[model samples]
Target: MADTNKQSSEKKEYHKKATGNALTTVKNHSKENDLKLYGSCFCPFVQRVWISLEVKQIPYQYIEVDPYKKPDLLLQINPRGLVPALRHGDWGCYESTVLMEYLEDLSEGQSLLPPQPKTRAHSRLWSDHINRHIIPSFYRFLQEQDQQKQVTLADELKTEIGKIVDVADPTGPFFLGAGISFVDIQMAPWVVRLNRVLKPYRGWPEPEPDSRWAKWVKAIEENEHVRATTSTDELYLDSYERYAENRPNTSQVANSVNSGRGLP
Candidate 1:
């Protein structure tokens, strides 16, 4: 019991705040507002909503929360004390994908989803694919400690990514072509982590230069909004070290992966 408590305390202390560009973004949005985003810089799920807000030019306050500590205020808003919770006036919403959709419903500055129903549905299908397949595979690959198992998991991750690549637009950049859409923003943070965190720690290889995957990666890397919401690569490496080592972690995603269950 003492060891578990100590580990929890250490995790909370280790992940206190965001740094670099993300820190700048947090400062910019520090002022009080009706729209508030409770998030952590170390979280990719939070990044998804953050990117959506930035891309759509939504006016919002950024409130950093240590999810593991489960502050009273955050628990009131999300109950689960999850980051990526959105508070609008008196109402509150959680879940990264749901928050993105809620922001879209506001009909704010820009539209992340397309106008046509068919295209929007298509976009949603792929986004769900990402949530269900790509992300789970990523964590499984990241948290697997055995080298032989890692090899198999790496291939599974690659296969899932390749499925997306195959369905994406044939031309240069973005999932649905020229303009950035919800799908691109949805998957951007993980793409960043794939290169920054997974490569060095898990021996994940970079996509070939001329490959479609590389093109998509280049687009995500060059996105101004994505860059604004991301912290330095070093911070990401430090944040994910526990997952790489397959050590006990309190994160919902890590727990799900470790237990052979679906991501929460």
Candidate 2:
């Protein structure tokens, strides 16, 4: 019990500096809340759960954990020491998407999944597609140094992002419809990060003008939930820069300008 108390004190100290430049801090929610999230501000995966909590109006204690310096408590909850682990009372959950669904199940507010069964299934499918195909392909594209390979990667990423437009609802602002769904929460972090960080410096392509992707981007940017959950643009870019430098073979493109380059 004494050891546990000591660790809790250490985590609190770490959180003071680890909140980074996020627009939302622990202060946004009350300390008495039983729901606690262990994560860093810089992680987009973490942002997904954070956005869900805000959108659902679920009060959770946000505990910032440095991903690089895995704390004992974080490790105890998730053996991998990954960020975005959630603890409600004595129960714990890991993985951002899993925790998002768990939180949705536990809380009362806007349904993260769509009401229609088919649409909800589709939402789950899109989330899976993003995790399996889009993220990996885009990261690989950014890390590629060879000119021909970079071109190939750029095309791959363009095709993948275009898929989101193809799958998005034609009648409205979000991926599902008028309301933000689980799919939207899953995709928003990467979309926002890419637009702010990669689009300007690395020449990542924007969805075509007047297209569904364009509309979605505008709507997401205007979303109150997204606005509240997201960090400042300066901090977002700065964190991504640092991340690129840290990830192996990913630094070259992040460091270079895309002026007159083949990247699109």
Candidate 3:
């Protein structure tokens, strides 16, 4: 209880400080300015912006926020209480998929959105599909407590995930081709977790990342900007454990429904 209280207090303080800083900075911000990304380790969506910023070689201030208890400033900027919110100059934006488009406008490097209208439309189509279909599927597994249900979800998830990858990735390594595209940034975070989860969990088969995605991720990950987010594998593992610990004993919730009774 003490630890929880301390953590909550710190979040409150961070929120206060962040708000004061955001208004002053936004009031006098300019283009090509330093970027600020408020994100959670658990949010794959935020990871999208992280990858975009890295690929664009843009420097950003990364602020970690708690999804359970968000800071006031974060809520002030994004009332929806979403992760991966970004503040660029006076403009504050939320939603991981949308942030990809914003990154393209801020920095120039490889084009994330295709130049041609037809091709760009195709790109957006697949991008939206993953968020709509693929992400929810992950939640199904995340919520599962019974190993049997988890296995079922995992199997279905693997098949569906493969289709999403196979269909979206054209002939190139990157979803957009020769280089990493907005699709790459949008999908990479979830891909990393999906691939990692499959390796250790019995529910899913080992992942076979598309040739292009594998190569593109390697190259993009090597960039100086991307390196900041990449850390020892142990760090990622600790984060996963912390998330599980934070959740209200989901197993208990599942069992409550299992005992011929519903969650109360």
Question: Which residue window of length 10 is worst by lDDT in model 3?
Answer: 12-21
- Superposed by TM-score, candidate 1 places the C-alpha of residue 90 at a distance from the truth, in angstroms, of 0.9
- TM-score for model 1? 0.94
Residue-level lDDT of model 1, residues 1-264, one tens digit each, is 999898867662235688889899999999999999999989999999999999988899999988888998899889877888999999998999999999999999789999999999999999999999999999999998889999999999999999989999999589999978999988998999999889998988989989989999999999999999989877888888878877776488889999999988
Candidate 3 per-residue lDDT, tens place, 134-168, comes to: 66565556556677777787776766666656765
Q: Look at candidate 1 and give me any clashing residue pairs.
A: none
Which scores higher on TM-score, 1 or 3? 1
Candidate 3 positional error at 77, Å: 0.4
Evaluation by lDDT, superior candidate among 1 and 3: 1
- By TM-score, the best candidate is 1
Error of 1 at 217 (Å): 0.4
- Give the lDDT of residue 248 in candidate 2: 41
**Top lDDT hit:** 1
RMSD, candidate 1, Å: 2.9
Name the lDDT of candidate 3. 0.59
Give candidates' CA RMSD values in order: 2.9, 9.6, 8.0
Residue-level lDDT of model 2, residues 85-134, one tens digit each, is 99889988799988998977875877898678888789888898888777
What are the clash counts of all predictions, listed in order? 0, 0, 1
